[model samples]
Target: MRLSICAVAATLFTSTIAAPTSKFDSLANTSEESESEIVRRDGGDGKYFHEPGGDNTLGHYDKRYFHGVVSDEERRDTQKHMVRAYLDFFRKNDLDTWIAHGTLLGWWWNGQRLPWDFDLDTQVSGATLHHLGEAYNQTNHSYTSDDEQVKRTYLLDVNPWIWQRERGDGMNIIDARWIDVRNGLFIDITGLSETHPDSQPGIWSCKNYHRYRTDELYPMRETMFEGVIAKVPYSYDKILTDEYKESALVNTQFNGHEWNPNAKIWEKTEETLRQEEEERKKKEEEEKKKTVEQAQMA
Candidate 1:
């Protein structure tokens, strides 16, 4: 969900290239050595190399600027594919997982998506994490439609840490990522560490990180998210309260759009007037200077 404004404007403002129908076929026919080593060469400032971590700290540089090059349509398609892949995996394996945080917010209404959603979020159990890492790590799965134009591809990227059981503060419990390589949209999967029976109920706890009991998380319930079957924490009210307080549900303006608190949708409107006014004043000042110069020349 980290976007560099300059990067987005530069990449998306231009026309899109039609994706080649035979692209995946060509990739499939290529040698395994070459395919395994396919790396995106680095350029520009060292900015692109920075690792995206908690809260997008690495990706957020200028408050106004974001990184990555992708169109809105392409971005949406990427996210949709990611969600589909996760659901497919869940259905096939019969694994129990649920949407969390902003993702859960999307589920609060219809099973559809929020127009401004930046990324996908979900959680899995430790046992389920092991099952995926062992069988589906770094695997490519394709979704095809009867209409050839709608087909898309995705990859399951399972991290190695799922197998390692080290109790420490810095470790991340998440085991895998559902990636839309073509557009870079991804879903983050974190594990809910199992607690001993003697431990208190109602306090959510994770041994790999700071501990919290189930009470901290309160209730969990069944919910549908991203047009798929899933579950979500019942403590969503408390969770949002801590993170955004009442503002999480408050209608506010961002990037020339009004974000609806109740519906969690971003609507475009007169919010862009300020940006337009600023651009207009700048042009007027430049024009006035040119007029003065012309009179002196005469």
Candidate 2:
């Protein structure tokens, strides 16, 4: 049940774009192709340049992932299912995963999925990634949906460049992913390894140039996230504060979206979706008009 990314992307490009209530919203707010030299390279940053939200990948630093429009409700539901699916898969195989970065932030906030998050983040030991790359790369693990009628397929795709211990992996530093085979939404899994044998004993770094001391992350704390058992860094509070600053832990209204205590969901205070729709329509109209003019000249 394993398939190449190109095969999946080509198929999805022809499929109906997901609705506004679906589980994917291409991160429209990111500054695509920033001046960061770490990203302006020959092969670009991410390996798979997906068509918008057609894939679960972030398409980092490029305007790569730009399709699919899912609502808040659909987004949360999908997040839950996706995380649960990964939990089940990892437990069965004895692969350890812990919530990191934004996923950890979500756990700190409410032990639930962040409404603003479009993807999930976790980390595994370097050995775990190597085991996956060897044994399960691109292998499909299928599970029945929550309804128990239809089936869902997941792929554990590992990157070949996981051995590059240097800090300049660009977007490729993401050593592996657990992808939802249906629509390509995936959770980014990074490998945390020692700096080098000769270097300091506790030095650690990720592909994204994120360096950390070993104690900052060792001894993963098992906890519940989105109703499923999960793991987080030992120093989750310190990690969250260090990465996101103090406001992220306390601020409820940073993004255009706000966390509603009554509904227990993050809701946008403004018509951001409506505005984006108008922008999309305008872009389409402009393209159509250009096509009409070209036809007259031809």
Candidate 3:
């Protein structure tokens, strides 16, 4: 079933990290809260999510969680769970958001994440951004698969510089993130607002300078992505074309992978590529032989 901007704001609550109750609960809570709370107290140097061993200005994924690069199957499975949990959390928290960037493009193709993408992207309205920060920043949401075999936890962490509407220092282009604590994979959540409200009437933009018209985004369309109901921009085609150009929608082959319509997914096979190369060589040989035969006849 489709879900729209108006349909968001559901009251269902997902599981969250239970508060520690051991004799060391106080110490554990202090340590656990310090990571994010310290950044907030420092007035934020504009960096939000920090890498475990790296600098604090890390933009998207946290390397510590990965340990090492995961296999393709693991990445896809984790991403799918991440997106579904994000949608569910937003709905329950009464927040409005939609798939954006590469994630949206994936939806257009087959309601799935792009095979080449290692992360996901989403967007929230300016108002929703405030609500998220004020109400759900640094909150965790946990969910289980339908069969209850797989369980995943996600953290909704908001950028402290969210109030700075303009694209000031560029350190906080992303307004927030839905992070999977297990693998450190996360969904970038940018916020759209009227950066120049007095002059730019209908224009909307994020800190990253990605702009869209009011009508192009309002009354968002609803569809499913990664097996969960989600929202998308109203003029998705136009928006995507503006960002990625017309080829994005029409080009089926990308990054060594080709769309398999029969399977309804993109596939990459070394054997298939080898076979294609052999077939191409055979055709070229046939054309050369025909040319030689024609010359002899003449």
The most accurate candidate by lDDT is 3
Better of 1 and 2 by lDDT: 2
Residues 40-139, model 2: lDDT tens digits: 4424544532334334434411232224555556656666787888887887787777788888777776676667777888887766766777688869
lDDT of 3 by residue, 1-298 (tens): 1122112324112223221112221121233344457467534654665554443223345654655556668878889888888898777766678899999888877778888787788988777787777788989888998789889888888876677667776766877888888878788888887766567766878888899887787677666677787887778879988999999887768877888776677898676778878988999999999999999999
Candidate 3 overall lDDT versus native: 0.72
When 2 and 3 are scored with TM-score, the better candidate is 3
Q: Point out where model 2 deviates above 4 Å.
A: 1-75, 145-150, 169-171, 270-298
lDDT of 1 by residue, 157-255 (tens): 665444333343343344466766565566777655534334433233333453434444324454445544555554555665565566554435644
lDDT of each: 0.52, 0.64, 0.72
Provide the global lDDT of candidate 2 against the true structure: 0.64
State candidate 1's TM-score: 0.58
- Could you tell me every candidate's TM-score relative to the true structure? 0.58, 0.69, 0.74
Q: Candidate 1 or 3, higher TM-score?
A: 3
